[model samples]
Target: MMKIRKLLDIRERSIRYGSVFRVLGKWPYEPLVDFLLVYSPGCDRKSNLVVSTGHKAGLIMERLPLESSLEHGANGISTKWAISNWDEWIYPDCPIEDVFVID
Candidate 1:
């Protein structure tokens, strides 16, 4: 349990620093973390969901794992990775906009 918490803490810190976060999707630039998928706030017509890749968003998703796919479908967005419990997760560093853009 502590390990998970520790990992979460580290992840949160990374997010706070604008480190690369992962989600399912393709981006034009090279994300800080290449192992996982990168996501931005947006809706998918076919999926009908709103997905995000910001640190805070990922944290929230991590808390609730069961609702992952459902959330993706309902929210019309994809995640870089599958978390344990996305429903109970929270990311404090999420950008104001749903989407994360790199200029």
Candidate 2:
């Protein structure tokens, strides 16, 4: 796992769900770290579900109940889907696969 060097700053607002912060961390390039930071702004919006970076993929795989069916947001699906698919802004040039530890 990549070690976060420091949390540069944090901001909180109702629209942002909770704490929003800039963290400094080592990546192969500075842009990669920047890319990882983009997800912070997206935390506030409501959706069918929220998947975050620190939620380990292994934990998700282990705990997700098989009988449950997730109700995806049909009306706000586009914007919600965009959140799932879009890369964060700090490293606009870095590909998503290289930035977030989870896909």
Candidate 3:
């Protein structure tokens, strides 16, 4: 409980794709902490039919653990990695023209 909460508090958060989200950091990077596959994907890894949130994304990780992490980086997780993994899950990739709103 506290261990999880503590990670949330101290780490600059982003979406994850499984308990073992290769990508880490904030909008950029996060270091590995635990050895268990109990984490979820970041909320950003969604198009629809999903509750977009950091926790929900991470929670799903426990249900679907990936075999490996994303490509390692010091400047944060790669957007390419995020999108490719997301596409694997979403299938029939949904394309957008332009951003209507920025987060």
RMSDs, each prediction?
A: 13.6, 14.7, 13.8
Best by TM-score: 3
**Regions of model 3 farther than 4 Å from truth:** 1-50, 53-68, 71-77, 91-93, 96-103
- Going through the candidates in the order shown, the clash numbers are 25, 1, 13
Indicate the worst ten consecutive residues by lDDT in candidate 3: 94-103
**Candidate 2 RMSD to the real structure:** 14.7
* lDDT, candidate 3, 1-103, per-residue tens: 1123222222333333222322232321123212122222363322122223343342223222232233442222333433445435421222211101111
The Cα error of candidate 1 at residue 79, in Å, is 7.7
| Reference-based lDDT, each prediction | 0.28, 0.25, 0.28
Kindly list the per-residue Cα lDDT of model 1 for residues 17-62, writing each as its tens digit.
1223332333422232112222333433222122343343333222
Please give the lDDT score for candidate 1.
0.28
Model 1: per-residue Cα lDDT at residue 71:
42
